[model samples]
Every structure is written in C-alpha cells, then in structure tokens.
Target: MGTHQLTTINNSDTFEDSICDLFNHLESTFTYKRFGKNGHNQKGIDVFSTEKDCAIQCKKKDLSRKDLLIKKEIFNDIEKDVNKVINDDLKVKIDKLIFVSTYKDHPEIDEFCEILKEELNTDFEIIYWGWDTLESKFLANKELLNKYWSNFIIKTDSKETHFKRNLDLKKKIAKDFGNWLNDSQANRKLRSRILLRAFDGTQYPDENEPDEFGQYSWFRAEIKSLYHKGMEFIIGIDEIQVFEDYTWDFTSNDNEPKGELVNVAKVGQINFSDIIDYDIDGDEYYMFPHVFCKFIHKGTPFENIYYYNLDKTYEYFEIKDKRK
Candidate 1:
C-alpha cells in the first residue's frame, strides 16, 4: 500500500507508539482496518488499511530513531517480497505499495525508493514527514510536525543489547546522542552510508540472484543480526560518498569526476574495532568497502567533516575476507 496520502506527526517515537499511531491515524481518519486473511499477516505489509475500499500496505521504517540513518534500498526489496506474497495470494490485480518515512534523505530509505520507481515501472511515491519535504508540500501543515516531534524505537537484538549493556557497564557509550541530533542543525553534518554484510557466510536474500521478477536484489537491513553465529545484516554509514549522477552496479558504479565536487575520499584508516568499545584482539574481522555516491568530489576529507564512498573493490567484500 504505497500510494495513499500519508501524514505523519513525528519521525521519532517509541516502537509501540509509532505502530499504534500509524494504525490509529490512518484507520480512524479513513474508516479502515488491517486486512488479514486466514488471520495471517504477510510480512512487510505492516498496516494494510482500506480507504474508500482500496488496500494500502503501510510499511514502517525499520529504524531505531537513534543517531543513525536507516538503510534505504531495503524498503524496495521489502516491496518486492510483499508484492510477491500479495500476488501469490490474489487472483485479481493488486493496488499500490505506499512506503512511508520520516526523513527523505536517508540513504537506505531513499535508495530503495529509486528502485521502487524502476521496479514497479511507475512512480514509487515514498512519502515522508520532515522539514525538507514539509516546506515543499506541507507548509500549511507545519503545525503537525511542530506538535508531534518524536521518534520510534528500533527493535533491539540480544547481541546488540549485550553490547549496549557492556558499553553501559563501562559508561563508554555516548548518552542521548539521539537527542543531540534531534536538537539542532548539527545533525545535517552527521551523514552515513549503507553497507551489506554476510555473516552466516552468505548474504541474506542473495543480492546477486534474480527473483520471480528476474531482478537480483534484496530488502534494506532493518532487523539486525537476523541470523546468528554465522549471519549478518546490511549497515548504514555516514562516511560513504554517494554520487548524485551515478548508479552503484557491481562493474564500476563509481563515477568519473568533474565540477564543484571533483572527488570523494574516506578519511584516515579503516578500523572495525574502533567502533567497538570492548576489546577485539582475537576476534576475527573482514573487509568489503562500499562507496557512498552523492554529489561529492575527490579530495573530500572525512573527520567531523565530509567524506566519500571509496571506489575500489577489494579482492573480496568490505565486511569480510580481509581479516587483514
């Protein structure tokens, strides 16, 4: 359900609250309820509401409402999966797939949107409630954003909780970083990119293979640590440079530079353990670099400053194979 007029009050709210509010606002306003056949929910289609008898799959953002950007393209993958499930269930043609978000600039969130437009072979209209989009479309509804400014909680993992607990025990973690980003224009400076990981020794959904649609793709990394011990998830980052005019294909997605921003470069060195507060001297590691392409140029530095998506591909992936 991605074609309805969605109006969100806030980007930040508790998980329970966001889900409840999303259901309530749309259902009450439109006289609709979730459509469940055989008392079953076909995943990804979180809120399937019917407005004027039309079905809408109200997909929520798989995010933490914290200081990180949600991975973008996965939403498109979700749409594919959801559509697959929907089509398999239906005998007649289906309706639209409406993806709702709070922020429009999120890489993972935005990337999938582009894919949706292409995959659906039509306008994958992703609606969001943010200052950037607000001024453009909802200057009249500015009061709504101002009134309900909050964030939704990203579901947590046991391992992530363990890691967080460890960090909490040592008081090594930053407190209220989310609040910091929420408070000012400072968040604009804190950008991140999205990366895919294969922990169970293989990529989930297998991006290189084609689906019934014959497209080799997968959804955004929403539920982290989906597989354990040998599983992995895609991650979003702020340092990767995404070129505006370029597309990321396996065979040379990086661009030939020109104009105001000539090239984009990563800062100092790559250190996986640096992000980990706990020790990792013995823990194994890997490397598979992803170059975030935006309107950036070469020589752009990363350090509380601008960065670039590194262009070169290793003999292997960025998050694996390096152990080097």
Candidate 2:
C-alpha cells in the first residue's frame, strides 16, 4: 500500500454524494441525506442530518484548474452561502451549518470564515471543512478511502515493510540479470530494446554525441555481455541501431560494436526466464517471477505482458543449467 491523497472529484454530483457518505461515516449516529437537486429552493444546504440538526453546503472546486492561491472571490462566495443558510426559513431548526469544499486549506480562508462567524451573530455554529479535514476523515475510514480514491491506499507499518522488501527484491533481480548476461557465454542472443539517458559526461562516457532532439535516446541493441565497475553495469553490444534522420540505421559505414552502461531503472522487458532450460529430473526447480521493468521516460514497452498478479500464486520454473 502507498500513501493516500484525496484527489479532486470531477463530477459535482459524485462529489456531493461522496461527501454525504463521509458525513455518515464520521457521525454514525446521524444519517445524512443529499438535499434537493441543483440546490433548488432548499436554501443553501446541499446535505442535511435531521438527527444531528446539521446542514452542509458543498462547494466542489478544482483549485488545480484555477489559480491555486486563495482569492477574494471565494471568500465572497462563502459569505453568500452562509447568509443564505442564516436567512432561509426551513422546517428543521439548523443548529450547525458547515461549508464543505474540495479546496485545500489556506490561512486567508480560515480568517474569512472566522470573520463571517463573528458577523453573522447567529444561534447556530458555523464550520468549514476543507481538503485537509476531509483527507483525515477519509484515511481514518478505509471504506471511504477505497470507495472515493482507490488509486492510492494508506500505508501501515507492516505494509510499508512489505513494500520495502519487494523493492529490495526487484533491485536484486536487476543485479542478477546483469550477472546472467555476463556469465551466459553460450552463443545465444536475445533481441531487445533499451532506453538510455542522453550522453552525460558525469554518468555516460563521451563515446557518443548527445541526442539532438531530447535528453533521452532509444536504441535497438543486441545483449551480448555485461561488465561492471563497482555498481555501474555496462552492457556489451554487437549489432547496434541508432536513431538519426527520423530513421534507425547502423552508425557510419563501418558498423562498429560499442558498450553502454545500463541504467537499471530503464531496463526494458526482456524475460531471461524465457531462455532458461527447464530440468524436470533435478530437485525442486524454483522459478523466479517475471519482473516487468518500468522505463522512466518512455511508454510501456510491451502491452501483452501481464503486469498484475491476479491469482496471488507464485509460479516457478526449473533451471537446468543454472549459471554460477
């Protein structure tokens, strides 16, 4: 699980419904219902709770689409809504009026709310629930978090440890792949593509010029062997294709061989397990799981590869000639 952030709900109706659900979750004793459609003649209240004598006016605003900074116009809008609730004649006596907004909290907004509260001189309590407050309540309840924002989840201590362990395992697999590329001396070749960061004097040796178009370049290279200096793993290639003049071609008339340092993070999808010789007669053959590499700047390399583990089962393969 990863850290959670409350994303803006694009649909205004959906945002109101979610806020209703969140209200119910927070005040379990009270059942909150959505007020009339389009705010109609039902005053400024968007949601209400009869049991709690509470009324909430939802303001769905996407600050990202607008200037992120708080403005005077928003404060004016808040004042108008508060006044509507104060003056409107309703069936139930509203003891609490809350203004719920998707906007992130700002000190100016808080000061404005306080000033409104003082000037109103109303019997009911005036409250403002901003993005920060909503996020805290959503995180406290997993059901609300999953229902509204499912992309990211709350990270507990045990889940955090598991995530760290999985990351470490992926790093180890990358190092092991580099070693396998070096030790597999057999004349077997795997057709693969890799994305390389532009020739930087600090990271990459100045053997090739910097790409004219961008900071990253794609190369179709044959994985021949691997060499390492400390933590850096350099890959040796024989047939190299460079992108030039809007086409991929061999460099110069004499197609020379070259070596490139592999950025472990940018390693493309080359299933080393596909080339393994399965030994059925040997002891229990443990198959390593396939790791789909995520390139930094490029789109997904292969769409056919299933990136998710749906069944939660570990499938193993037997390696007949396991390289040392």
Candidate 3:
C-alpha cells in the first residue's frame, strides 16, 4: 500500500475536510461537520461530532517542504490545540478530543501525547491519529480513498489495462530517449559533459556510497546502449570522472573539459515506474520518468546517476539540470 498518498493533499483545508469525511463514514452514529468558515474562530476544532460529543483538530504539515521530518513545532502546536479545545466554550461539551495530522507516526510525538494526557488531567479521552492510521482507514474504504486520493485506486480490469498502457508508453519513451542519446550530434553535445545528481538511498553508506563530503557526487557519462534485461531497463554507459578544478558552466559553449576518461563500459539498471508530469519554462508540459541508474563502481554496486528527459529540439536532446 502507498502510505504517501495522503501527502499529495497540498492544502490544509482539504486535509481537514478529508478527516471530517473519514470519521463520518467510519462512525455511523456520529455526524461530523466543519466547525466554522475557513476554520476561523474554531477554538482549536476543525471538525466536531455533536452526536458523539467529539471534537477533532486537523494538523496538515507538508514534510516535503519541511525537510521531510517531524519537528518540535508540530508537537508544540498539538499541545496548544489540545489546550484550546479544553479551555474554550462551545455549543456542545466534548468528551473526546482527537488530533489528526498528515505526518507519519513518530516515537517522540507518541511520547509527547502521553505526557500531555498525564499533565492535563482531564476527564475526556485524548487521541492522536497520524498518517499510518489514516492510510489504513483509507485502504479499508474504497470510496473514501477514491474520493481523497484518486491515484491510489484499486486495480480493476479497466484500471489494470490503463496501468499496462502507461508502462508501454514509458518503454517507448525510454527507447526514444536512448536513440536520441546515441545520435552523433547528441553524443557530441552531451557525451562526458552532462552532470547528473546521484540517488541517496534510505540507508546511507550501506545502500549508497557517498564522497568524503558525506554526500552523493554528480557523475558524467555517455550512453553506449539501452536495452531491456528481464523485467528491468538497462543502460550501458562509459563513466567519466571530473577533476576538482573542473568548473561546470552550462551557459558557455566551451568544449574543453578537465576530466579523466573511464573507458570501462557498465550496465546500469533504470527505474521507469516513477514518472513526473511538469511544465518547462511555463510553456511546454510533458510527463517525464526519472531514470535511476544503479551501476557497480570499484567492485561495489552503487545506485547513483539520476537522469530525466529534457526537451527534444530538432532531434537533439537538451540536458535540463533541474533537481525535482
């Protein structure tokens, strides 16, 4: 199951509405409603279930924008919301207060909630629901999942055929890009010159070997060939190691380079499943799949060399070095 589906909700209001809808569907006895217009004067309550005397506060935090980690600010916000709900006037007295967040569950957040409950010494029960809980709930309810995250729908006959079609389209795209890369003019323009960022896996040095700076290094390579090996798409390339003094300036047409030629041809496996649809210079829009190349370096297999499809101008491929 894709637990990251909920993270696609780009706004706080939508997230709060989703939480409200989820609880209303899950609990048949309770009927939840949005507390106020645009959550103004809500008294720390975004959703309220009057029938069950329950109050829910939704916290939407985009971890991607916030360095992909839960911080103390979230905990502090939760504490403040809990306090607001406890020490405020409302139409109906709430016996239960629930805090819902788009963030994944963390040990520190769990422990903090426990501490808050103990210190508050309230008669009502306090509950915290993170992304894990939301994901499980959405998985169980097809309608809810489809309503909120349309991308995570279950595969039916038609859906399965659509997925297969997308895969076939990606294969064609890869083949086209491979052909373009092998062209004489394209080869002359990009060979041993295009610098690509390396993939940083979850497990640091174990899964990916970084340079002395504790970060992945950009690599330059020339595509030798592209083919399908079993269920994987493989790219054959001759890796180039650039010198320390080599200045990477794409604006200038300087042909000189200070890099060593690594004549060893390596077969790297590419991932075509992750596709991103974006616009270029606010004009042209296209769907581009990320090319994750895993090749063996110095006898150790390293999953580096990230590539993406750039704009094709007059049968030549232009390298757009933008980190998505």
Candidate 4:
C-alpha cells in the first residue's frame, strides 16, 4: 500500500510475509517459523505457522532439474521441524506442505514436489510465482486494486481473505522479483563476460546480480587472486584477466563500455519485503524461490555450482580475512 521500498526484501521472507498477512487478515491460527535440517535451519521453510498449514521455500537462480536435489534436501529437513510444530508448538498435525519459490514447475519441480509429498507423507504444494503467477496475482489487480484496496478485499477475499490479501502483496513483491529476473535475463543476453582479477587478492561480490533478494548472484570481475586453485569458476564469461594491479581497462569482450570498476568489493545483495516490521505472530506463511548458478571458465560450457543461499555468501565473506 505504501510507496516505500521493502527494507528486508528477501525472496523467502517476502513470500512468507505475503502468505502470513493473508492468514493474519483472515484471523487464521498460524505462526511462521524459520526451520531446516539442523533444527530451524531457515535456509528454507519460509513459513511454519502451526503444523496444519505451512509454506516452504527453495530459492533458485534457474529452474532446472538440479533444483530437485535442493527441494528434496530442504523438504526432508522440514520433516522434523514440522513434526515439532505439530507435536510441540501447536499440537496439531499438518495436512499439506506448501512449498513455494520463484522456481516454475518444470519436469524437475513437478517430479520432485510429487515425489517429496509421497515420500514424506506430506502434501507438498509447490507454488512458482513466475511471470504467470505475477500477472494473474498482481497485474490482474492492476485495474481493481490500483487505487482501491477495499474493492479488492471485497471482491477476492471473503472466504479466503488470507489467500486474497497475500495475493495482493504478492503482486507488489513480484514486481521487484520480476525486475531482478529481467536484469539477469539481460545479462544472459550478452552470453559472455570478461573477468578482471585483483592485485590485493581480495574477493569481490558478483557483478551481474544487484538484487534486493540476493539468494542467486553473479559477480562479473570478482577479483580474488591470480586465478589460483580452490576458487571455482563461474559460467557465461568470455575471458578472464588477472592483472598485477587493479588498474585495467575493464570492458566487454567486444570492447563495449559498461560500468566503471571500482576498488570496493561488490558484496552480496539484500531484498526487503512489503510486510516487513508488520507483527507476524499469528499469520500463516508461504513462499516462492529460485536459484540459478553456474561457472564459466575459458569460454567453455559453464558448470552449475549450488551454494546454500546469500546469507552463506555473506557469512563466508565476512569470515574470510582480507586477502593479504
């Protein structure tokens, strides 16, 4: 409703908040919790409202069969958390496990969610808020909810107000996600990158990705060191230039000019949600997530490499001592 930016605009949290707001508006009995393999892991499990109704997340950069592994891992990870919420938190068993994310339903997602549901004995409702869901949930409300929240509530929300209100917020949030997706798609259009390394051996953040939700990222010339071993190669780049000094005429492989490269280490991105700071004690939760990552070394086929999430990147970044 307010025309301010989402401060903590994480894909998972935002998605969960939309779901939570819907449930809260409808006065549903729920509490969104952070959970995972190591006891409330939080890498996934966007919403853990009670045990009966729940929402999960698996953010991906690209929706590929590779995501099936992550989905399976997180889904199993939630079993104990969901069980605790059921037997411990709310004393009620869950009927369905709604797993939502930016990932669309491909052979991987479809096959995984169904297999996960059957294997885990929990109904996994996967929601991929791709452009389709965005248009239907947000663009659809363009005419009615543009200036009239009341009309929107009256029209779409009577029995399922939670679902309705969440859909409303989903519209706004998806706009941002769509924007990030667009940028990524644009970068992909280039189809090539020229890496520029650092002299100080300092690690830099990704370049292609400047997202509010930074689970998936790309650092164009993340100048770490002189192309030593241990650091994995990223995909889609044309060539890499490891210079002795920071000074380099960094440009596209075709000599096209882009943004000026600075000495600052481009760090991970953070995204805020519209529902941040809203009291989230009694709201149900849901999610939409996608993570696309690959490494391109020497212009050959890029290899896909999966990291946990943006948080891990930040944590790992901070823990690393400044390159000597």
Candidate 5:
C-alpha cells in the first residue's frame, strides 16, 4: 500500500484548491466549476461538478486536533452554502450537496444534515466526506492519489487492499474470541456479552456526591461490579463534544421524580462504531463487537444522550485467562 504522508496534504492550503481536481480524476465525466478567486459571485459554493449535478463545498480543518469547530459553527457554514444555491437567482438545481473536509468523523453530522434539509424544505441529498472516507476514496483510485501527492511513490498494492488486510485481522480476533467463549462454561450462560462502558471517567466528583450531576466514579464502580459477575472484556464510549464553548445544564425536567436527577454524562450524539478509535487501557483488553445503543429524547427528536443503566443485564463475556 502507498505510504505517502497524507498529513502533508492535510496541513497545506493546496489541498483545498486540489479537491475538485482530485474528484475530476476519480470520475472521467466530472467537470468542476470554481466560484472564483475573489469570492464575490460564489455565494457559499466552492466547487460545482457538472457530471454528478453536485454542489461541493471544501472545508480543510486541522485533523490532528479535535473539537476545533463546534456543532453550530459547522451547521452554519454548510447552511449558508446550501442557501446560496437554493435561494439565489442562479437557482443551481443541485441533486446532491457534498461537503468534503479533512476533519475527523463527527457522528452528529447525519442528524444535523437531516434537520437542515427539513428546515430548508428541500429534496436534495446531503453527503459528508471526512478524512477516513477520503482515504478510502484515494485508496480505491491510485491515480487520484498520485495526482494529489506528487512525491508519493506509487506502491504495488492499493488502499482497498490495505484495508482488507486490517479488516481480516480484526475478524480473526473476533473469531478467536468467539471460539474461546464457546469452549468456556461461564460465557455460554450469558445471552449477550456487549460492553456499555460509556462514561467511566468523564467527570470529577467532589466531597458531596450530588445526584443531579451524578458521580464520575459511578462508571468505574459499575465496571468493578461487572467484573465480579464474570464480565472480563468491557467496552465504554463517550461523546466527542460538538460545541466547545457551550455548557449544558445538568438539572432534570419536571417529568421525573422530584429529588431524582438525570445523568448529565448521557447527553449528546455518539457513534459506537467510532469506539474503535479509542485507546484501550493498555493491551490487557481488546475490542470485540462494534455496535451502539443510542438513547434520544422522544419529544425533541435528535436530542440524544448516553447513560449507563446500572440495573440492566447483558450477556457476559468472560475474558480468556491469556488476555489477563
């Protein structure tokens, strides 16, 4: 597989300029129209591809850093660009709106895009192109990679080949873990061995453990309880904050018991699949299943929160002695 440094492309301004060029190389029929260098007539649109009938906006963010832009900030940027096409006199009949960026994957992007579509009353589809997705596209087409990275010495294998190799390794681990489970008596008793370690150490607790904010140590204690019950490998997930500057009120609404408080750690949109990106607390543990259970407020729709149910029972997976 190609070992060219994509970070160099991420850190340079040329990446934004070359985005349309890269897409053109991918699809032979693609035609890119730049809004202009002066940024006067462009509105919010950056690059328009005639072949796909797509209006593309290229955003190059600091991929090395996380939470650089908040949720509203990202929404606002995309909204303005979409409006420029819909409301402007040009009436650019775009079938698809594509946003290409170098930022890490944001789970809330899909929900936010749907909200925008509903608010605008449009039928256009929204697509987000993050770093990993872009990497996949580059790997699928080496010509596109060579065109962008002039210094890249084309490797013998493609990116798809490299991905398959990694995926195969993960499957082998899962298979081995499954085999160990089938061989063990303890694991065979449990219905599900899913791990729900979402908020182990997200917050700090003080002298008085307030029920409203909840104790940060609660998750740690829960894990201990699970371990005592024969759960060996545990999986936990947390929200990657969308808004950096805003503070959420932890108080519960009038719907619940008077003194009982809602768990504030359970707030925001989280993609459990992204948990693979999280570092394990050393090699003592490994990831098995890649799934998530999202809890959202029924009244407000996309207002999602994550909370660990202390009393909930899941099928337990006893860790093999070797992993310990």
Candidate 6:
C-alpha cells in the first residue's frame, strides 16, 4: 500500500470524522461523538469516545512545507487546546488525549506532553499521532481508507504489486532469443563458469592433493541444462569449505578452485510465467524470475541453486565426452 497523507483528504472535518469511524470498528464498545465544525464548535476536542475514555484533536496542516513558522503554529494550537481541557469539566472523564496531525512526528512533542503532564499534575495520557501512525492504521483497514479518505492514496496499486508485469517481461526476453538459444547449442556450445555450494560436511581440499576430477581430488564441476535455452555443459565448481564462507566471485579471478569434481545432471527448463517459489529456511522467494534471468545474463543462478544435487555425489556421471 502507498503512503496516505491525512492533509490530502477533502477537509479537516472529514479527516477528523474518519478517525472516529476507524476506532468504532477497532473498539466495538467505543462510542464516538464528533462536535467540531457544524455550528456546534467543540471546546477543544474534535471527537470524543466514551467507551475508550479518550479525546482526539485533528489537524490537517500543509505538512509538505514544514518550517519553523508552521511548527510554531502547531505548537500554539496545542498550548491552546491543553489550556481549554485544563479548565473544562470533560477533562475529568477522559484519561487519554490524542493529537492527530498530518505532519511528521517530532521528538519535541513528547517533551511538550511530558511538561504539560507534570505541570498540571494530571494522570491523563497525552500523545501525538503523526503521519507515520495514521498511515499505518489506514493501511491496516483499507476499506475505511477507500471509502472515507480515498484521495490520500494517489495510486491505488503500487510498484510492489507489479509481480505479473515483471514476470511477463522475463518471458518476453526468453521468447525473443528462444530459437537462437536452442539452435546454437549444436553448432557452438556456450561454456560458462558456475559456482555451486558444497554439500554439508564436505571436507576442504588439502593443498597437497593433486588437481584432478575425482571424489578425492577436492575439485568438481557440474553441468546444468536450460531446456528452453538449450543443453550447454556448465562447469560448476563445488567449494571445498562449507558453502557459507565461500564468497562467489562472478569474475572467477581468484586462482583457487573451491569444491570437488561432481557429476553433471540435466534439468528441465523452467517456465517464467508460472514458476513456484523456492522456500529456504521458512522464507519464500520466486525462483525463476530471479535466478533463471541471472543465468541468462550473468551465468550465476541464485545461491544454493544446486545444493540438493550436490548432496548426492554421482561417481558414474561424466561430462568429459559430452564437453564440446
């Protein structure tokens, strides 16, 4: 959801009324009464709720252009409201006083509230709800925002909601180069340097060990096939140390090889439009949109792309004869 500014609402009265309405649903027992603009001017409170024992004062200032002059105006208003509540009979009924404004919350308000509370020797809780607080509540109950304060949100749908559009873009790229990628494999194989995470408990290769393709050789590579893109034998280096410590250098400029020689496996090409999420450690992430596109452009799949395959080492699987 986009950020909703309270000042952008039609009028200050409407903004104040909508706030009372929000509390009506949030607290079922709360009885909200508005007495601000319609001939009956509220003493200080714009809205008051009996069940919640609270009073709200709403202000819709030009929050975008905040200066010392504007801030002094807000402070003066607060001082006037506090003075009114101090002498009023309703002060005894409500314990919580909330000041709602479209402006960004400042630390000075907290200091001001503490000073007022101490000077008056009152147990009443005084607090200010700035743009941040109001925005959160508005987002939580979107129906209220849509009906009463629709103008706050300039765009109903934000860039975060464009997951479908992003996927479509990826698919279009694949389609544009699909035929060439398929046919080029037979005529000329595309070789790429891939870094694969090591299986758990895999021992790091000893410096004394010979550089060869074997389980004991401490260096291995695997070939992953992109179905739509075609069959290209990708050399995946399995790191000697645990996968966590190994930083993947996309340039492959580091002179040391990380993992042991592992078997090559064929994977079916993934459809970008309808790809399932990859769940790792209870976190869900869209796999195809992220990794496949990277492989198409950067030659590196998402981290832990081949972790499952790395777990079971295949001695018989070979890429020597298949390498072009």
Top candidate, metric lDDT: 3
Greater TM-score among 2 and 4 belongs to: 2
Candidates 2 and 3 compared by TM-score, better number:
3
How should the candidates be ordered by TM-score, best one leading? 3, 2, 5, 6, 1, 4
* Tens digits of per-residue lDDT for model 2, 263-287: 1111223322212121212223222
Tens-place lDDT per residue, model 1, 104-136, is 434545565556657666422433333234323
lDDT of 4 at 306: 20
| lDDT winner between candidates 1 and 3 | 3
Q: lDDT for every model?
A: 0.33, 0.53, 0.55, 0.35, 0.49, 0.52
The CA lDDT at 127 in model 3 is: 79
Off by over 4 Å in 6: 1-7, 36-41, 151-324
Summarize candidate 3's per-residue lDDT along 1-324 as a digit string, tens digits.
321344446687788788788888889754898888573788878888878889888887766433223556678887888888777766667888888877766666777777888899866677788878887787788787778777764544465665775578567655555544456644554432322223423432233345334544333334333433211222343334334443222222356534532222233433333322211111122123223333225322233343222222323222323222
Candidate 1's TM-score = 0.29
Q: Which candidate number has the best TM-score? A: 3
Every model's TM-score: 0.29, 0.47, 0.48, 0.28, 0.46, 0.45
| Predicted structure 3, TM vs. truth | 0.48
- After superposition on all CA atoms, what RMSD does each candidate show versus the true structure? 17.5, 17.3, 12.7, 20.2, 14.1, 16.8
**Cα error, candidate 6, residue 62 (Å):** 2.1
Least accurate stretch of 10 residues (summed lDDT) in model 5?
221-230
**How displaced is residue 85 in candidate 4, in Å?**
7.3
Give the Cα error of residue 307 in candidate 6, in Å: 38
Candidate 4 lDDT over residue span 56-105, tens digit each? 44342333335445456545544554454334544233444555444433
Residue 145 in model 4: lDDT: 35
Per-residue CA lDDT of model 6 for 23-132, tens digit only, reads 78677645886855757646678888877788888878874342445567778777788777877655437888888887657677768877877887765788888777
